[model samples]
Target: MQNNPKIVLLNGYGPISINNELLELYPVTTSHGAIGFPLKSLRAENVTIVTNLINFWSLTKKMKPENMCYLYAYGGLEDEDMEKIKATSIKST
Candidate 1:
């Protein structure tokens, strides 16, 4: 048997809704809204949500569910920020 990874991607600007049994990744709206992805639909041992830092902070403020994993990424880094990051060297032991 093999185990695969389940990941949900969100833009962080769209609205998210959570009901009794499901969590909508992106809820539909009247003006330019994205389709929702029900959490219940994914049948996996582990589910990871990938989003920007700002959205991660927002989600934490609302609710921090147990066993839920989140991976935050830098969506848009300025030129200076990119340069700084590029200058930073990593050392592996």
Candidate 2:
């Protein structure tokens, strides 16, 4: 299709839009499902996702910096989990 794909997804609020183009829109089988494998496989420069909270957290925990993310989820992530993930995630690289 000439128009960009209309991605129906669960999350990726901040990783999908870099230079105004959507590089990828990863799907989630469920709220807690991971997107790392799918995202990495796409080799995307940017991504936008609309999913549940758990999907956002899990994918954010593993995304690469070059692959910017834009994730949107209802309700915010738990403070403790986000803290731990931010400290431990290698996404900065």
Candidate 3:
């Protein structure tokens, strides 16, 4: 496994792009019920996640600084929670 996989944390609906590459989308699942792990735990490699702000909060709380996050969704996290995450913004053309 790559020690530093490109991890993208998406906010909002639809696809999220970082730098110039569009991340592969992964939907949040509940069909199997709550798993015994954080969402990040499930991803061993680079992954792009399509999730709500709630899940995004949980993920960032324990996220490593090396990971890259793209926030497009609004609400859920507080100012302090936001501090924990090292967020990257989309540049306007």
Best by lDDT: 2
The full ranking of all candidates by lDDT, starting with the best, is 2, 3, 1
Report, for every candidate in turn, its global Cα lDDT versus the true structure: 0.31, 0.36, 0.33
Residue lDDT tens for model 3, 18-48: 4444543333221221112112222212233
The total of clashing pairs for model 1 equals 0
Candidate 3 residue pairs in clash (backbone atoms < 3 Å)? 11-73, 12-73
**Count of clashes, each model:** 0, 19, 2
Candidate 1 collision pairs: none
State TM-scores per candidate: 0.26, 0.27, 0.24
Residue-level lDDT of model 1, residues 15-59, one tens digit each, is 223223333332222222222332222222223343355555455
Per-residue lDDT of model 2, residues 1-93, tens digit only: 342222222334233432343434344323444433211112234434434555555665665544344444234333432332221122321
Alpha-carbon lDDT of model 1: 0.31
TM-score of 3: 0.24
True-structure RMSD, every candidate: 15.4, 14.1, 12.7
- Model 3 residue runs over 4 Å out of place are 1-47, 72-93
Question: Model 2 misses residue 64 by how many Å?
Answer: 1.1
